[model samples]
Target: MAKNSGRGRKSGGPSSRPTKPLWRRIVRSVFIWGAALGLLGAIFLATAVLFTMRELPSYSALKSSQNGQMIVVRARDGTELVSLGPSYGRWLSYDQIPQVMRDAMVTVEDRRFREHIGVDPIGMLRAVKVRFERGHFREGASTITQQLARNIFLNNSYSWTRKAREAVLALALERKFSKDQILELYLNKVYFGGGAYGIDAASRKFFGHPATGLTTPEAAIIAGLVKAPSNYSPTADMQAAIGRGNVVLGLMAKNGVISQDEADAIDLSQVKVAKEEGQNSVRYFTDWALPQLDLLLPETNEPIEVWTTLDPAMQKAATAAIDNNVPKGTQGALVSLDRDGGVLAMVGGTDYVSSNYNRATNAVRQPGSAWKLFVYMAALEAGYTPSDRVVDEPVTIDGWSPQNSGRSYAGEIDVRTAFAYSKNTIAAQLGNEVGFGTVASMARRFGITTAINTQPAMVLGTSEVRVIDMTRAFAEVSAGGTSVEPYGITKVTTTNGEVLYQHKSVQGQVLVPHYVAAGITDMLQTTVATGTGRAAQIGRPVAGKTGTTSSNKDGWFLGFSSGITTGVWMGRDDAKAVRGLSGGHAPARAFADYMKVAVAKRPVEEFDTKLQLPEWQLEPDDEQLQGDPDDYYYTDENGNLVHPGTGTQYDEQPRYDDGAVGPGPGPGIPQVPDYGQQNGAMPPPAANDDFLNRATGRGTAQDPGLRPGQGTGVVPRPSPSPVRTSGAY
Candidate 1:
């Protein structure tokens, strides 16, 4: 009876099995798989969403950095002379970019850039496919927003961990910044050709025009080169660039930016090759003023304009001086600052494009006789008169024999005459008379923060000092004894016009009286009138000094007018000597060329007469100096053992008087204990670590222990880690 209930099944068949409808079996299997998959998907979705929410940095809550934006310095004439960056990069606003250039960039780099939310799924899928097929990392799927996130917030590291971090950051960026704003930053900061970073620099390099003024064809050229700068460089390979330009045009056409007819009609053959030229920007000006920026603008991570005291005319003149007067193959640096410590102009090196090493602010080389200002100031403060007699004679101290390069001897002369003539023997004797420590102290007071060894030999400028420091010291002298810390920025404001930081002049007393500083000025003027600095003389009154280190390794000319102070240095990257060259030869000549062009444009002026010092009576010597309680005595520059309290005795003979003789024992110097001298034996000479911190008087002997920013310890983490938990599992 049960078997008959079913269709025409046999009795054995019905007892053996019961059959279900095909549709029902399919439905059951579908239900089971669907439920399992839905549960798995729900769990994965929840975990991914939660993890992302937890790890992602707050978009609106991201605390602005202390170094939020860069500060750009404009000269008095309204020319952009320099810029200081949070990380050596500049950020521009959306409106600052040309609309056409912006459009072209989007068209060539990402057609769907404006429509996506930081990432493009289609592009991502294609990238994944390409990567799989190539069996390696392939084309990027990151949109402009994603790139902005990676470049601005996350560090570049190729790892799943880093990629996850970038993804989180991309999400945050999309929430924080507007599409136009993100694209503006990306265009402004993207790497293009050579070492040039940013569309602005690339525009100037490839099209010989500013980003704002780029033409359609020129913009196409720049846009095309961005994909693979080295491969499609107009200067490196014109054929490759043309081919790339065609590709960009095709992409633009494909994106409906222009009709195919228009694209085909565009003259690819008319694309002019770009020439590779040295950077004409003011790289030196930026470097020389970096220290002042660190001091005055503690918080600089925001967009702001810095109105500087720079004279564009002076900058051009200084650059010309290096190019026109310096010998071929001679590399150098020059800096100019106002009496208020505002940098006016600078030439960091022969060419900023060829080398990024800034010699004006970073190079530390001996200044030779140029450092005599400090020595003489110490002598004058110690009660020595300019008319006092001193001898230029061969001498030795502490088993070290210093020799004058000129090699001839000059008899006793007045202090003023000795200095005017740059007599090494007289300088050494004066430095000895006053404690070498006194010289170092005087230099520090005037703002030379670099460590000057306390040894007597330092009088000849054995320690290395940067040109920027030298220029600032001279600015103090020009300001009539008030030391103004050199500064590059004036004000920093946010995009919404909130004042983040401002720099008022930093003032301090470095010299005792205007007379002391004036005396030094007058001495420097004499150097220009009839001494080594004669070449630096301008029709308007000027004062300066020339210097050459041993073996002619470094050359320098530093000077100042009533309103401006300048320092110029010339040498090789490896510190190799320039043959037959001295500060007076190329350095002074360069100064002269610059002054000739600069002085004509500036109003003629002299220092404030009100700051003039009153004439004072000269005393023979301090009789109050008492003998050392201990029996310790030391040899002076003349190799004569002197009692601790006894002043150095001057002889009438001088050393190496203007090459009349071969090198002789150098002028006498007092035996001052060397603070930097190694214990037991001399330690290895310190390597120049300018790259570590060339600016920010952060490591001067003033604080045997110092670092940038005030903190207990630990370098602060930059931004925040965007990497998070795996979403795949």
Candidate 2:
């Protein structure tokens, strides 16, 4: 009936279409709702499984950051001169940890640290709310594990990804390790500024003690530094550091770790904030010593402990000498290398803490007269004896005229005296007599490896050389002519106590005997005795040379005792010429000062006695070899030669033949064969001389062919061969 009236009637109120079969409808409805429920149940199950099985991520493993142990430096007398890095951050077990330090860390950083798992949900939610309000993460809600993980594994950069990574790592770390393990690591990993890296470093850097030795107030002060290091640094801001310390104390008091009355009673004024010296520890030494260390021990990458030949007392004494002795505008470096090439002490610059450039090893300045040693050595080896004389007056060579330091010369002096006085002309003359090649070769033997221009001017100290090179050369002289390569590290050890490497002195022969070295040493001693190096003379036996470059631009003092060798270089850091400064002034004084202190405890002894040598061969007089023309030439010994052509014999006499007695003790001139007569033959033997012929038995007593000494019998000779341009001897 409704269908019949559909055109005029409104659509059926509830069911316009034909209703589906009851069973089909019911089944369809049940399938739709059931499929939706099944899908929801599967998602819930997957989420539950994920929550149960998921594992947090791990972080980069941190081996202990505490590097080396306190290296002790003692004097030659076994007296402790200085102690370096005395406090090492040690990871302590729960039982060994001091209660006061633990409580201070807990009270200051995290109040409910022990009660929480690895994270604090409420604290994180609060941080999230703050971040939402600020539109960025301005504050942190890191749990102790999270903070420790960040401190040890990550650097300070605020980011969501890093934060999430830190959280994952912290959760993993907490699951794998105990709370005490995390806390102990955190204690050792945190930075306390002022060159302090860990709790122990902070303790020593701040309180002049170890973490285990920290008092309650001292612990609070150190704990307070973790918040903002530079701001809470006692040296930088004492008032703020004290306020932070007081706040840490109040927190400890409120947490029942310390009594309120006890905290209030504590006087911050009496708490001595021991100022850290902040030694940018041996920056210069580190720079200079590393390359050498690498050479000495190249097998491993671990740092080698260079128990250098550095004498701490000498180092202090040297620093003081440079500070007190050098002029206001100049800076200097002083180095003392042991006979074995160990660096006993080094002051690379005026102050290593202030500057890192090592002028002593790195600066290549003109060596001045110091370079003359090589020149003299070359001359000596090339047959120009040290006793040979040379004029010290100015002489031009190769269109270059070199002048002495004072523009005056002491003429006609021996090599030793001239060298002691640093004569430029005599050195150049000797260089000319020998050759540039010989001089350069000698310099190379002395460890001058870099290119040295083989000019005659080089003999006058015009070439540039570094102090380390000269020091090694001079040390070899001190050690008896044995060339020693310089070394810094004695040994290197891994963190696990395994020996990675050790250094031994490697030496080579540069001279024939220790005597030659001793002679050189003796000559150099004269340099200190009566020459420009007189300022370097110490109470004991000392040998050295002083060098002042042109216009006094660079000053140098190289000195050595029985056991140590030192080189001092002084100049302007900018290479600008300094006025009125010479090696005799500040560098020599610095060398002397350091030597006096460094050698105080060591026993006084002469050089190794075995190095001394005896005299060498001496040549004969000149006149004896150059007297008469007849001495060098052969002539007839008899008065005349008889000619048999005529029936009556005719006398054949030379025109120049007079009773001159010529060169020999004879009545007439000794006969020399005429050019045509001796053209293809060796000359006949002298009238009264006994001669030996290696090729034939013709002249000696053992040979039957020899002529008699006086009136004589005929001597038989060997068969002759044609002579070339020169006759056979």
Candidate 3:
């Protein structure tokens, strides 16, 4: 039939049956491919994680190993001076931590720490969203557990592999340790600024106490340091640290760790950071002593304790002296030593935090008039007495004309009077007479290691010297002219009570003859009594000199008593001239300030005057006499020498006069004029008197009209008619 044939044709040809939609088919194919690709990606991620975990350090290995200990320094009396090491301080237990500190840490570092299972997925997602919105990563989403994991067993690296390891390691740590144990390890392993490691050390470094006693605000401040130790350090940046602390407090309040009222009640102004442990105000002294450690201990792996000669009271006094007397923008250094050359106090600069130049031991500067002490020592050794008369008239040495600071010269004056006035011309002539080589040799004997020029100008302190050596040189004079090798460490002991080294008291050899020492001491005493160093009088038998160089670039005062020797230097590091500054102004004041406190506990002892007169003065003969009897010596109403003499009465006592000229000088000798009536060329007596009165705590009130000859009593006659007598000596 036709129908059967049509069916057969239709069956043999393409038949139109119900077909599926293109969209459904496409959807089915995509589903199958996506499932297979996702399975491959998961396998790849699993393989990467397994490889990263293999590189992770063992938990037991990291937990067992401990860092190195500290090297502690102590004062002679057992007061702690400082500690030096990589990881220093005590390790605290979990129960010992303050609740406030825990709250602060949790609030700032991880609010969901208690709820998270090691890694906080929700927090990470939020952080990722924020980073996506910002187009860059600016915030961290590490939970406390993750942080602890990273700190303990992982290095800080920015890679997906590292992140995967951190996450896996955090999970492992969470499973192996309790929450409290994790927190304890984290607190003990964190690094704070200033070489402080762990929360306990950080607490002691910033608060001077243990972590258990931390207040809420203090806890907040410490917690803030976790972000950036140096950037948030209270010692380095207090304002920024406080700002961060306030942020922590805000977070704590938001997290309900503390009430809003409690958070608001915190007074940031009342917060005070403890002095940093290793780098306190005594860093100068410690730095100077550090190099000596090698010579002291030699070899030691155990924690050692060095007993130094540093006096805490004297250090405080020295710091106060510089802080109160020296002006801002100017630098100063002070060094105090015992008569036997033991360092008591050392201040290298105005602020140790600002700079660590160690000006006391490292800075080399000109001594100015202070160097005259060595020159005079040479002169004394060359058979010249302090009472010997030297012409103060204009003189030239090798075509170099030396002039007085005031530009007005005294005609003829004894060595004692000329030295007291810091007469430059007299010093130059004396240096030439004694031969600069002799003076330089004497300086070396006194422990001056700096290069010395043999020029006549060296007598006026043109050569530079270190303050430590200068102080040691003065210490020799204080020790009755014995050479002193300055030493700081008295003993060294290990923490286990084993003695490493004990200092032996080595008596320095007698360098200067007894008579020479006594004569120099007497002249220097006169200098403090009525000379340029009158500003350094400490109400005791103090002897010192005032040094002022050209353009006032450097100023110094090196002085001492029977007990202690001190030297002070004030100047600009750049060598810029300081206007109106003189050694008699600030340096002398600082010396007196420090000495007053240094000797407060010690008994006042008088210098030896048994050999007051040198052998030359005692054995004076007709050959040593050059002037008339009345011209050289005149008796006062009380039987005191009015001009110059070598008797004990003139030894330690300052001569005083009522501005009266006794009689006209001999022929060709200039009559001393009343310096009270002079003008610009005359030095201001009020400046000198005010400094003396303020420094010594004596003398009458400041009087501008007071003349140099009016109060001091030792008057060198001015050249009679201002003659230009220029001739080489």
Candidate 4:
């Protein structure tokens, strides 16, 4: 049909015009499609740009509303100690930022920050090539403006659409703000970790100074955190931060931001990280206090201030004392309390960085001889005077007989004397005479919250107890027998100074009888003056008691000086023995050192010296009773001495140094035959006769030579076994 029209040679016929080459047609079609796609892409990009610009805030609003909530902790004196959430310092201007910091940031983050209009094609292409070669995406090519855009508006989710949005926002930011403003915004808005936001906050938090005076290495370190705040933050990983800082220095030198020699001259070690108040030892206090916020304040994420009773200076001294006195590989914890039970200082471990177990409040360990306080209190409550004499001879209660530290004893000692010397035999005798239930009751009344095993061994502090509880008990005695509920937060308020909670220092209800408290205090004073706690003497009218567990697994010194009471514990985390580490030595020394600082500001206040009791004289010497020197004449339920017949009669026990095992259920304390050795001398010790090595603890707390529920002796594990009310303590 078209051939018929060829007679007229139609101008528009495809055959009238020679057909175009196939390749040319293909090229033309491609050009048309590319043009249409380019138009659509342009429109799509403009739409994305508009969408990204929708929710952006003005610079003023951004600055004012960035950090939402923060919990700041302060000392009693209103000194800022630490904060929990995002914390910002004063906003710094572009001129205020150190030039080294600016240079470091630019060289490491974006070399073409000034030349590019928010994004650099060369950098993008180079990053793409590297990523393609590596077969994975890597973080790079983000200009400073792009970073600022992301920090201000976008979250940390990665995607193609996210990249497009970031580029659009970056371009918009560059158009909206000058280069200096963009950089200032970037530095001020970026997260630098450690609860710090902005360069100023980061500088103050890490270096303990303002950003205006940062050193080259310090500046580089701070700037390097922009890529990954937690990774490069000095407080988080100083080594990684340092390495990245070195890389930044090298880059700065190569990019002419700094001279090569200048870069080399800087060493990250010279950059001292400014220590927070109390050298971060207060972190223990904050860790202890933050959880209590829910109980103390109204439920809200709103920022608040916890005005704790923490004595920053005392905290620093306490941590230093532990670090200096605690032997290497062993751990020590200390906590100080005021008369009202305000935690003035708390150190959970020798190094908070290495171990954060919080031994002060959380760890439940054996209190050793320190448990004698409650036994003496029970005796006093039962109408026994401190002057009442008791024989410190080996006594057996229900097949369990614990000896003194060195398997030695001091006989015919008074109550106060026994307490001062931490005589396990006398303590057991008194505990047995008063009824073990009464002794456990007395411990409960005195604030020993942990389970008291109440076995005959419990008389020697075989039960587990926390250091804080022990300190609280002593605090009660220091408060003239008033109850002491351990407290740290004195008041809580909003950042604007509106008080949310105000602690009223109410006089606590009497927890112990007046005579009982006085008696215990008297014994404590005598202990520090002449007994095992003599090492705790701080040149003040301080009173304290010492405690050492079997094989010296745990050593503790709980004391009160001036208006402050402190308890210290030294032990291994594994509950293993530390030879020769007794409460009278390292723990007592730690208590003295910490107390020296804890009570430095307070006036020396002496404990009650007057004691009321019906005094009695000792029985006249009897040669028949002197047959077996190792024999013990225990007091009956009525506080009457029960002498034995056949001249198995008990005499005054021989003296022993403080290393022998005490009288208790503490394992590894060997059982000896009753009445065989001449001159009342003990037979030579058998193997594992040192301490109760055969004693076993429950719940993974095994003694060095002991197992759970096996051989007799003090166990390190806490047990809920019923109190043997009928047995002798």
Candidate 5:
């Protein structure tokens, strides 16, 4: 009505259109604001994607970074022992992938794998909703392609940044590679646990075969490892892995990869995880050989296979021997070497899971009478035959006297007899006769690596030694005096069948004369036949020596039988003593138990040469003869016959037809503790320090060593860290 003159326009006022409904105006305003916000969000998301892509590695770098191969260690029998570093199986094309494996991977990992373009919005939204409700990031919707990209191009870190990068890389991979190619790469590079990185290696590792031969259930089992490798690996836990495999089978049925009946019929419980060398026992050998491998080859990233000389069966036997024989509170170690010095078995401790200290190769302790081996070896090399006669009375060095145990001396006995009896006095006399310098040098020449103390007491093994060194020394003797250096690796090759390194055996130099070695073997035979090492007998020819330290701190039995030199040691890690423990009791028995299984595969072998030592026989008139058990008579300190365990003495002496003087042969024989009887049952713990020092004239500022045939109490210096070089010290 106001538009009468100016064409319906109001002058001096705002112009306006016809008024619309309030609801329509409100909807229009809301639409305009929503459009602006949506544009802002789109721009922000594009900037974030670009930021994540800034650090993205090139797709070609994916295969290049994984170019480095795994280091596989195998036993002598070609059984896999362990794998070091990223391990992958042979790369397979899409066609080579078993249908079961492909379906199992797809159905269980990503239900919409065929439909998604790198990232699935539905799966991500569902996963996000579930995670938000749960308040913890547990459920994941990562596809196979996403996992492949994550493993190749990124670390397994849980962060928004990592997720952004993984998503960007997945999109890039999807854009470049075909679905089949992407699936092939994913299956070939995914980690399936057990130190394996891919389906093929995991297949061979868990099933001892190739992926081509994987059964449906086996494929399901392996596919299940993708989600949680350490928890689902058959080698880690069989029951858990089987349960996971069953879950996969259910998914396979739901996806129609397998019929429900087929999935139900699959017995994953029958899945026998390949029984490879995963025992903690083999860790000892692998630990020792790892350093050796480094020395043999220049460090590189290329995959290498190390073929070692370890006998898996023998390793099991050795571990069992230590676990069964070593006392509960104490520790034990054993090192066995072949005739060529190849390490066959090594057990550092009873349980590697409990304690990984490699006692066989690392621990440094007194050799006790085991050092007498070098002393006697020095004597034998210094022109003394085993048959040579030596007085078994007190022998002094720096005013230190070596006496027989319990002061029961076998006077003027032959060297063979004294050695068989492990007479402390005789050992010291020989050490005195043959300069201690020569004895220390003999130990060095025989492969004792620890620094040797050249003092007079060194002959009694005052210096510390390693079980591997002792075993190496014994291996030389077992090899008929040829020099030996303990070795394990035999060949190094790549998975591609290219030989990287092969051992070329060097001719061994003679460490001792053949006849001298034979002479030592002669006395060693006597020791095992009638001496302190009688318990180490394996019902066949064996030569060994028994060693017991002061206060029963350590026990040792070093021997060679059937071309294998094995050394056994039993003691505490902290150098504490085990009461009533002796070399002849536990250590020797352990030696026998191990050797029985160790030599079972080899033919019975006898020492080819024997020294023409005199036959030791107790003379009829001599007092060394074994008396009848009925003839035991209690004797007073003054040599008068008395009742058993009582001081009451009888002056009257009985006569015999043989005309024995001191005590009659029948009922008047003196009852004395038999210290030299087969070295059996760890004759009640040795006397205290004062009595032993007075008896052996020991106890000097520099000499903490015990008498020979008795354990040494030398304080062990802090041991040097184990050197892994192949060179001898």
Candidate 6:
């Protein structure tokens, strides 16, 4: 029993050796296993580092690689118009960079940037701990060097392998270059959104100044963009950018880079963010010129200088004219073409940023009465003079009865007078007489490529046509019947002074007879002087046509001087009619406004008007015509009927009024004498020949001046000769 007590005491009591507790044993095993795994992880990371370093780019390659330089567009005088590329400004050095910018960058991007060789282990561990506590990876611990490594050498793909490669590259970069050199390279290559790369370009683009002139707050704002440039763009969102800048300022103070008092002194209100000038103003012209680039430079990586024909002053004037004249919510486009078809200015729409659909070049709409130029040209080509008389009365063709806008008819008028009033009835009648096919052919001859219909309605300007084509056609007319193909680019050269391409002017074909063109110009002069296009007069002898569609959906005024031919179109894009809008109103007014400024420097030149007209076709004496009744009807030397009442002559009977009643002989004019057997008896109808001769105003077939019923047994006592008006006579 004593031996058993001794053994129990030895087992239960404190002895020389004591068994370890379960918790402590488990802890020891875990520690040992953890240490082993940690060693293995370290070995794996080192091996990865070795492998990645082997595949890394050489330092020389990194130093030589550069972002693409901008392709600068220039004016004819070599003035820079705009830049197109990734980097738009000069490179900035570390010393050129503002100290506040450097501090803000280092504080917000990497606090231990100076202390870390490349990767910050403390930052990484902290990131890992925070991520683990939050149950997911939500924070980044990449040092500035790591970011530089990725940006310069690797793509921004998230993966352990990529991250390991980035770490290796960063480490190699640290050993290869000093911290200042790395930071300089990073600052020079970092993208600051808005197609702006590098601190210099970002500074210039946002503040309109160099990076060396950045204020403390501006530097903070720029540095804050390192994380998300687009979200913190000063031009895009000022409040968000300022808030981010305040955060960066706080970080700078906390990191001992700046004093708290310095940060507190920064008033957010005093931070004047630079306003970026909208680059979309030239978008239309640039878009039109883009296709020419391939022909200009087939293969070039260096910056190429493009000399364009765009006149900035005229462009501004055109834009302002449309903006001021056209009603709100309605769009407008103006295109100015010089004598050689160089596009001096183009405003495709009111706001290019809102809609890039180039109305000037792409949109096709009906030209309304503006299309009458083609119709009248066709008539002239078909042997109808501008002085030819056409009765302006309602008529129907192919079951389509077209009427005048106001339903008021000027019974008989000359073509010139008809066109001046934009008489739709007369135009339709002329189109019918000349044939729709002939009118369409004339339009095609004038450089109109848009499909034209041969229907009677087409004579009233019912077809859709592009504004550019219309302008080109008018340019042809202005060039005295010579065709013009619109072109913009003049020359392109590389930065190394190598001429890539140069424009060669091509002579266009003559599309109209010179005399006919001059006659047309003379007629159009009357349009601007006292006609529908009166509003388009530019204080000089200007000629154009006013076109208002049937429902006033589209308004257009295509005019030209000797120097330039411009076309203005105003309407809604969706084809909705703008109430009270007409070609003679807004479009004509806009044209005048644009031309007033456009021709300020150009010498005033009159149109060529040497076409001869018969003496009888000249403007009638207004005093004698109202008093003398015999001067109303006569024949000119060319056998054309000269009518003083209508201020025109005709080679044939007015076609539409052939069967209508005519006014009897006027006062002091000879009357048809009665020749019936009885003195006052009605007579039977005469033979067809005699009756036809009398009806056509020719002498009766029997005798030269015999009465209508002389031989017949009919006594026509001049049925109370109806009151004769000038229109009827």
RMSD of each: 21.2, 18.0, 20.4, 17.6, 20.7, 18.3
Best by TM-score: 3
- Positional deviation of residue 316's Cα in model 3 after best superposition, in angstroms: 0.6
State TM-scores per candidate: 0.53, 0.53, 0.56, 0.54, 0.52, 0.54
Prediction 4 TM-score vs. true: 0.54
Per-residue accuracy of model 1 over 356-404 as CA lDDT, tens digit each: 4677777788898889989988876665544445666675555655565
Ranking by TM-score: 3, 6, 4, 1, 2, 5
The 10-residue segment with the lowest total lDDT in model 1: 720-729
Residue-level lDDT of model 5, residues 1-729, one tens digit each, is 655576876666645556789999999999998999999977876665566556555545554557335789999999998777776777777898898899999888888988998888889898999888998766578887788878776667589988877887777667667788888878888888756877899899989998988899899999999888878878656888999999999988988889999998889998877766545978878878877776788756677899999998898888888888898799999999989889999999887654556899999999888888888888877656665557776656787866565788766666777777788877877887778888988999998889998877777678999999998998888887889888989999989989888988888899987766876776777788888899998988888898888878999999998899999999999999898777888888988988999898789886745443232311121211212213345444455555443534565644334555445345755444444767663433323444445334456333211113221221222121122111110
Task: Tell me the spans in candidate 1 whose CA falls farther than 4 Å from its real position.
Answer: 1-73, 80-278, 287-306, 492-502, 601-729
The regions of model 4 sitting more than 4 angstroms off are 1-68, 87-279, 612-729
> What is the overall TM-score of model 3 with all chains considered together?
0.56
495-605: candidate 4 lDDT, tens digit per residue? 788889998888699887676777677778878887888889988887889999998899999999787889999999899999888999999998998888887778877
Clashing pairs in 5: 401-696, 549-711, 550-711
lDDT of 6 by residue, 427-535 (tens): 8877887789999999999878888999989987898998988998888888988888888888888888888889899988889776567667766777887788989
In model 2, which runs have C-alpha deviations exceeding 4 angstroms? 1-276, 280-283, 290-306, 493-500, 511-516, 601-729
C-alpha lDDT of residue 499 in model 6: 89
Q: Report the C-alpha lDDT of model 3 over 1-729, residue by residue, as the tens digit.
A: 445555545443345666789999999999999999999977875665566556555655655545444678888678988887665567777788888888888888888888887889999998999999999876689989888777665666578987877887777666666788778777777777666778888888888888878898899999999999868888767888899999999999998889999999997657988864235568889878866877777655567888899988889899999888775678999999987778999999987765657899999999989998998888777766555567788788888888888899878666777788888888887788778999999999988999999987789899999999999988888788898888889988889888999989887999898766766776778788878888898878887888988999988998887589999999998989998779898999999999999998888787763354443444434312323332344445564534434433332223345865444566543444333545434522323333344334465454332223222321112111122122424
Predicted structure 2: lDDT: 0.67
Candidate 3 lDDT (Cα, 0 to 1): 0.77
lDDT of each: 0.67, 0.67, 0.77, 0.77, 0.77, 0.77
Better of 2 and 3 by TM-score: 3
Query: Which residue pairs show collisions in model 6?
Result: 683-714
